[model samples]
Target: MQVAYDYEYQLAVADYWQGRPTMEPNVWVPSLPLQMTVAVPASNTDLVVSSGGQQELKLAVMEESTEYQHERSNPMEDFEKAARAFEDDLQKMQTKMHLFPPSMKGEELSKYSEPKVVSIGPYHHGKGEAIPQMESTKYAAACHFINESGRSVEEVYGAVFAVADEARRCYDADKLRLLSDNDFKPMMFYDGCFLLQYMLFMCRDNNDEDHPIADLPWVVVDKLMKLMPKPGLDMETFVGRVKQCLQTRRHLKFDPPILDESYKPPHLLGLLRFYIVGSTDSSTTDDGSGQGLSDNAKKVSLSVSVIELAEMGIRLTADKTTAEINKMRVTRGWFTGKLFLPPVSLDDANARFLVNMAAFELCITPDFGEVDDTMSTVCAYLCLLGMVTDNDTDVQELRKKHILQGGGLTNEDALELFTGLEKHLRPGNCYYNTIVAIENYRSDRRLWIKLYRFGYRNQTAIIAVLTTIAGIAGFLGTLKSFQ
Candidate 1:
């Protein structure tokens, strides 16, 4: 793609313009016009099952991925979003819009960092007197005031946002420096250009010898804010959008959306990027249109993603489960390949086989994604309705009520329960969106117990059956006799 010939070079008399037949003289170098690309790194999983104890359950996280590897490298913020907010306010103020009754000079804006510039604002921020744990609430209240009354020069007593506008008139950057020098904290900035705009406002308000503005990271905030939405709307939605904006740069991003996608947290690009990737091997592709993917691949991918989620959720529920099982500490027992489940964790995750099955079973079972709570529920439900391929012995023992706690049921038991619950578990009955059905059977609990419970695939099948039956009946009456 280098310049083969420069038509301009031929027409130009100057030697400087001499080049290939139809390109500029500088066009033939070690580069091409930049093109976009998606970046994907391979997945890595390390597994260990210990008997006496888990020697290496802990693994440190990887370093942050900064790869700009995207199909499009658009900056998170467009041009207009990067423009200063308060500075825009200042311009209007000069035209008698009165953002301030008395104007603050550009030099006065620099002294905002002084520490001595403390506040006893128009309202008590609480206490006789140091405020505690009420920053965001107070900040929001102040913002509302500024939006309403900052324009009215005649207004003296008003909300913090309006008065804050006037406070900026006497701002000093030096006082902000004292706040930073003394290590003042709880200093957060709005995500986008608001940080710089806020900085200018604070700098102009220096009624002290210290500068709090010096401590805030205006530059980094400035960079990130471009992608952030304007603040007039809701905070919750805005936070989620900021997360997605940064996540557009991650490696694990997939085109196909998952049924149960993880919630993207605000500004955590690192974790969000890793969330979407599946552990399944993509290096090789099978035409899995008919029979679907091999069992091994499904297990591997599902296990990794699910385990990642469980690790987050288990903090409250699984701590006891882990501690109870760990007491046995059968290191040598691990080689025998038995993953025994407590009656509790079994129900919690529906006894996923990888964790409970022996190494011998592990060899037979495909490496699906980690046994997440949802997947386990789905699997357990299938086993109950006889949809799962086979029966399990340990589960049967539970259904027999041999355990300390009862309410255990087998797959058939679950089916009967769901069938009995048809009316009770219908659309707004037991839950939202989830279809109630009995997937498996437990010996102790009555079948009706599961009638109002949830099932994913079974309900889907039920809908499909009804649709098919309706179609068949409609067509049968229309056919000619023996035709």
Candidate 2:
């Protein structure tokens, strides 16, 4: 007779487990009786056994098979234990990092979130072929940045390698799991060098002959593109990418680079973010801000749009009236508010730079559909502008007032700048106070009284009323004469 060993064994185990009403002293009792039995036909062979001998053979087979099972399970048991321990440790580390993964809100937002000219860290590494135009230039830029300081590339590489572990922890596990130190260190060093050198060129008023990147034809073209705005361009391609790098270099000037050894940014992008948003002052520095999100700073009330506040007798003026263009300060009066936005040169590149930074904030800030009160000030400000400027009319108003300088973008395209970013923001409740004040002033009964008094106070109303009555009388007299 044929025997189905696996099927029979499974059936025996199922019966044992399912039929048990009480605890057994030995769970292995079922396996003790289990053994494969086979019989040769009596006509075909002389190997037929008597009942007594067959019974003896079955017992012996059971003992040997049970011992084999025990031996095989020992190592498997150890492996399972090790796997459980490893998983626990991974979970703990993940909890410690608190990193929120970057989400693809949509194709439009995703385009802004991803790096164009350069890929910084693990999240986007190897996702596509390197941009042929930039790959060679990036390596050249790295060489220049390292050699310009009379330092070897190894020195920069070593510095980055030393902190590779810390850098890896900055990203979510899924993006980073396949990344090893060998793949990561080179990318970080190269990207860092490119960014630092780019910043150096931007901060300088003139590109000297010895400027590491000045001689590059690409660099010349990049600088030219920033100064000249293209008309009829609707999407970001060559022009947009170049502008983003330039704008970032420009914005970085406000915060400046902090080169102190104590400040260890998690990665190149994190380093860029530090200069843009993190304070250099020790008193304001965020210590133990956790691995994931930045802490709460404070929230200010949202301001009214330029046109609305103007109608309310508020004078809108640029606060950075001085030569320094990087200073962003907002000043307000009871009836007059001056919004000091540094001369913002709006283009696809500037828009992309702002949006990506805001995306970074959304990813790192702790929230449940709302931005943390302590979110990055830069992001909050950008979001406020995005919230107010919803369409072409708003863009035209801001541009007309010199509040926004549209680089190459038309009014409709300019709306995409802040409006697209608004999709993934949690503007906290801090800036409502200003709006509340404006609403209260608009609803006040005293405001109408003031308007009435101003009109009648100088007998301007009496002169207007008498002039109207005389004009009507003259017209009536003329009609009677004609009749």
Candidate 3:
């Protein structure tokens, strides 16, 4: 409509002047403001046409309908019922912590959690490359140990097979589903004998060659190399393999033979941890036996960083000479603290073994994150190390302080090795009491150092300030005397 008005004005001017409107000075050209609009149809049945329209209207239809309610819902009531059921189920399921801790179940840490060179327990009984190679070796060790007792391999198999069901009960249920009773017996028999023989060999005199393991291929190769006139065996490969096996094997030392029939370990790794933990002095190892110490820390407290600890007069030292992993000693005095970390050589093999041992300990523990007395001390020790050494710098500091045996690992690798080791690792009641003491000691020592340094630097200024105040007082008295 606005466009039509503008067009009409232009036509009237053109007809009057006989030409288009000129843009001369003091002359005005007529125009209309442009407005765009869309036309809407009216609902009336009678159509009324207009020459000009004032505004545009859009037509729309709104339909009316009825809504019905099928049912009423109380969501809060249903949620409360579900929550109560969940609590009950959680309490019921809390009894069994699986042999493999859920934290260690991921693929990123599987190599550390699974057996590599050897699988001793039923959890990793028959899965990998290690099984085939170690199976025959285990049988040989079994034969040698059984023959010493005047029992044949057949008798040992029968004996272990008889107790297969009981052994199965010791392991968590999920791992042994694929293995049958028939499979369980042989594996246990072979593994049990191997462990027993190895324990027996370690307990024997160092020079004793009568032990059965000396008859194995690698041991044979070692012996023959010593006796033969010419270079009998290629010393490199076999020697390295033997060296690795020795290091990777769980238990290194045996004091009293760990063959007490009264206490049956769950599996081979369990047996190893049993022995390792048993070797620690009862005074040092915190079994959470009592109500707990009077000064026991109420919360988890890791030590400060290595350099910070050293500055506080706390010394870090590695127990490189100690063979047992569970043996850690902490000593404190008024002015200083000492932490004797057990020697740890992290490589692929031992890291896996340690992780599996910790997982096994976690599984057997009836309740995690409590002060349980019967937990594995090895797990406790690993947790302590994990707490103390957090990163590459910590690892390097420990190495420099002789508190870590690198085991051919760089600082970065050692850092990764200890990473996430403490996740879901709750300390037992008596666990880390000594560390807590050390932490308290360091805190006190640091405070003292700060105070001492402050006084030492400001004492001269203090004397000078006192002298100036005295001089000012004398001048005031003289002025009063003059008045």
The candidate maximizing TM-score is 3
TM-score list, all predictions? 0.15, 0.52, 0.54
Query: In model 2, what are the clashing residue pairs, if there are any?
Result: 296-374, 297-374, 300-430, 300-431, 301-430, 301-431, 301-432, 302-431, 319-340, 371-426
TM-score of 2: 0.52
Q: Which candidate, 1 or 2, has the higher lDDT? A: 2
Which numbered prediction scores highest in lDDT against the true structure? 3
Q: Kindly report which residue stretches of model 3 are placed more than 4 angstroms away from their true locations once superposed.
A: 1-98, 106-108, 139-149, 152-154, 197-264, 278-303, 319-330, 345-349, 368-376, 430-432, 442-446, 451-483
Question: What are the lDDT scores of the predictions, listed in order?
Answer: 0.26, 0.45, 0.51
Mind giving the per-residue lDDT tens digits that candidate 1 earns over 221-251? 3333332335532323322332222121222
- Root-mean-square deviation (CA) per prediction: 31.9, 20.3, 31.4
lDDT at 180, model 2? 49
Give the least accurate 10-residue stretch of model 2, judged by summed lDDT.
208-217
TM-score for predicted model 3 compared with the true structure: 0.54
Ranking by TM-score: 3, 2, 1
lDDT of 3 by residue, 1-483 (tens): 333221221211122234534433322222223343448765734344445854445445454444424455799999999999867644533222245667676544665655555566565655677555666666567556555655433344445545556556545566678665544555555566665556445433432121121111122122222332343323223222222332322244532332445653333345445544544344442333122333433443454555555555557766555545555655555655566666655655556656666776666564645634336565677676666777777888777766555456677766666656666565553355555555545443556857644555676998898899999999999999999
